[model samples]
Target: MKNALLIATACLLGLLSTTGASLPYPILPPLFVNGAPDSLTHFLGLPPKLLFALALMVNPIGLLLGTAVLGSLSDRYGRRPLLLVTAVGAAIGHVLTAWALASRSYPLFLVARFGTGLLEGHSAIVRAMLADRLQGPLRNHALSWLNGALHLGWLVGPLLAGFTIAWGLTIPFYIAAGALLLGAALVGFALERKPRAAGPSWWSVARERHAFNLLRHDGLRALFGVQLAYTCGVTAFYEFYPLWLVEVGHYDTRAIALVNVGMCGLMTCSALFAGRASRTEPMRRAAWLAACVALAIGSLGVGHLWVGLVGIMAFGLPHAFYNAVVQAWAADRFGGGHGQGAVMGLLSTTFCLANILMAAAGAVLTLVDTRLVLLTGAILTAWAANRMRAWGSGAMAGLPPAA
Candidate 1:
């Protein structure tokens, strides 16, 4: 029953995570960019994209805060309730987003995005539920599917939006809302399980020595540290790649989407192998290979369009692999209720921190030169790979290395 619930929840999560939060970038930008009244400004009579950017920043802010609080809450209240709540919240948020779009209300739309962000369903309840349900190879397998779901969600979002735009933007929100509500229903009815235990208190979850103990548990730190560095590079590329293609490589939105398709394809293909690798001696080898692949892939951008596309493909495969490996590894280390919640929250926090740093560097690089940023990312990735290799070696020193 527990394993069944976990698998079911994973499917629901895959659907819920596919909502159009990230999709708006690819679709809505064209709406606003081509002299259409910026929806926010036209609807709300707001000043400009600057203030909107300030207010809309709440999306990611809410995401980070929501995931942190919800992760803890899931531990305390149990995964089922929190899952239902966030799913409902996401559903409501999307409905509101649709209404806001229809009514042409920028302020209201911002509120909807903030609400959507607050659900934080991906990292909190979904990951917690997975940790609660699965074990060993099965657990790793489940995470690989989840990793693929993440990319699948991202891939479909924009493609779906692009197609749905012919009908109107508001329709996508309605579709997203339906997905969320259905996900809620899946957890409510399909899981049919009791709460595991009382989760850890917020204050208690914070004390690192008691819970995390990375010094004693060096493997966990190595996993999370890889996440930190990997996210840094990935975020940098996501921020600048489109612009780099446009300015340096001379590609359009259609071309960009095609490139994204390649990325998604590589990631999906690599996730399964990564899951299998996590079970044995090849774990460390896989990580090193993935990181090196990312470095090499990222470096390919130093040349031309085809070269860069190959690089992106290479980078995406290793990245997708690492994501599953790290998450599975973290869950192995801290699979208990509150501990799982705390680990999920910490992972998201690390991702956000890395993204922030990367974004700052990206902004500066744009002023300096875009190619410089890509080159820097390649160098940083290589350096990070070396660090990870060292960490993995140290972790393996005590145990008979797996084969």
Candidate 2:
């Protein structure tokens, strides 16, 4: 019963964290546009393009710093305390963001987003916690469920935002804040504390050779590269997909949200299926290659409305499978090590860096052609897929086969 409760709490944390992270996506572009009455560009007195990019940039920067700092801290202190602190801090950040939006204060809003990113390292901690508690197939299954919870949150957040955004642009932030507080309460009460002897400080962890040594292994390096490339592709696709819809399909906010719902829904189902599928490492690698091909095809097809919709769904479905498989692979490698937090932190940092670059690139690419940006993502993803074939075969030499 206690184990079940812990798993349930972790899943809930995943849901809340992802929902909070995704809520702003459907609403932010319109709010940051030039000459949109009472928008961030108008209030901040900045160019529309610059303000839009900065809005995307700040959050990921905060996330990179926070994950790099806090993931190691969770190892030194304890997961329970770190989880509680970050959750409450995130809630506060959300409240402040809502206030900033209400007052039309651009600087305050930037600060709020940065703070939120710093505190949102909870996802890494949650994964580390689950990895600590479960082993082998059980761990993979639990993580898959957590992934499902995340996509479910993504599905709900945009739908909720689409509905409530009609009421007020800032309304979604307030609702997200409430969910974070609730998540804090759940973590405070449900998660059992397991303290260890103090581990190395964040700086010490960085200086240590053990964490760095893992990268010397060819398979691990490839896995990390795959994650980076995948994130780059995903960030590019999502950052511009809404704009594409508006420009090419003549869709409204609600329609975009509906499209997101379908995509996320497919992603959720794919993750759930991955949890049950009896997949070997080679098979998983093959599927990842196939997914990259689908993403490329879908991205290239985005010029047509129905074709683009199908492409987005195709991109989403394989994404869930690849994420679960790679994460499980990483957890297998890092399990029972002092560097779990550090390694996860590095992974989070990589993801954040990818997002930061893609966001900036997407903004600039809009100047050229929107479809070209997605095609660029397709090319990157395809390259990563081809690399994985060599890396997967080489990495499997000594590692135990997937159960």
Candidate 1 C-alpha lDDT tens digits along 1-403: 6676677577557645654455554544334323367566455564343333333355565575676566666666677777887788888888888888788777787788777877844565677677766677887888777777777766666566656666887877788788778888887886665646665664564343122343245445555566667666666676556656666666544556667677777776777566775334345654576566557546645767777777776776777777776677667655563377767766765665555566556556655566666776666666567665655555545433222
What's model 2's lDDT at 338? 41
| TM values, all candidates | 0.80, 0.89
Cα lDDT of model 2 by residue, 274-377, tens digit: 66544466435644644564464445445887788778777667778776776776776655564566666767777777778877886787666767768777
Q: Whole-model Cα lDDT per candidate?
A: 0.63, 0.73
Residue runs of model 1 more than 4 Å from their true location after superposition: 2-5, 28-58, 99-109, 193-223, 246-255, 278-283, 296-303, 336-338, 360-364, 367-376, 395-403
Candidate 2 clashes between residue pairs 3 or more apart in a chain or in different chains? none
> How many clashes does each candidate structure show, in the order listed?
2, 0
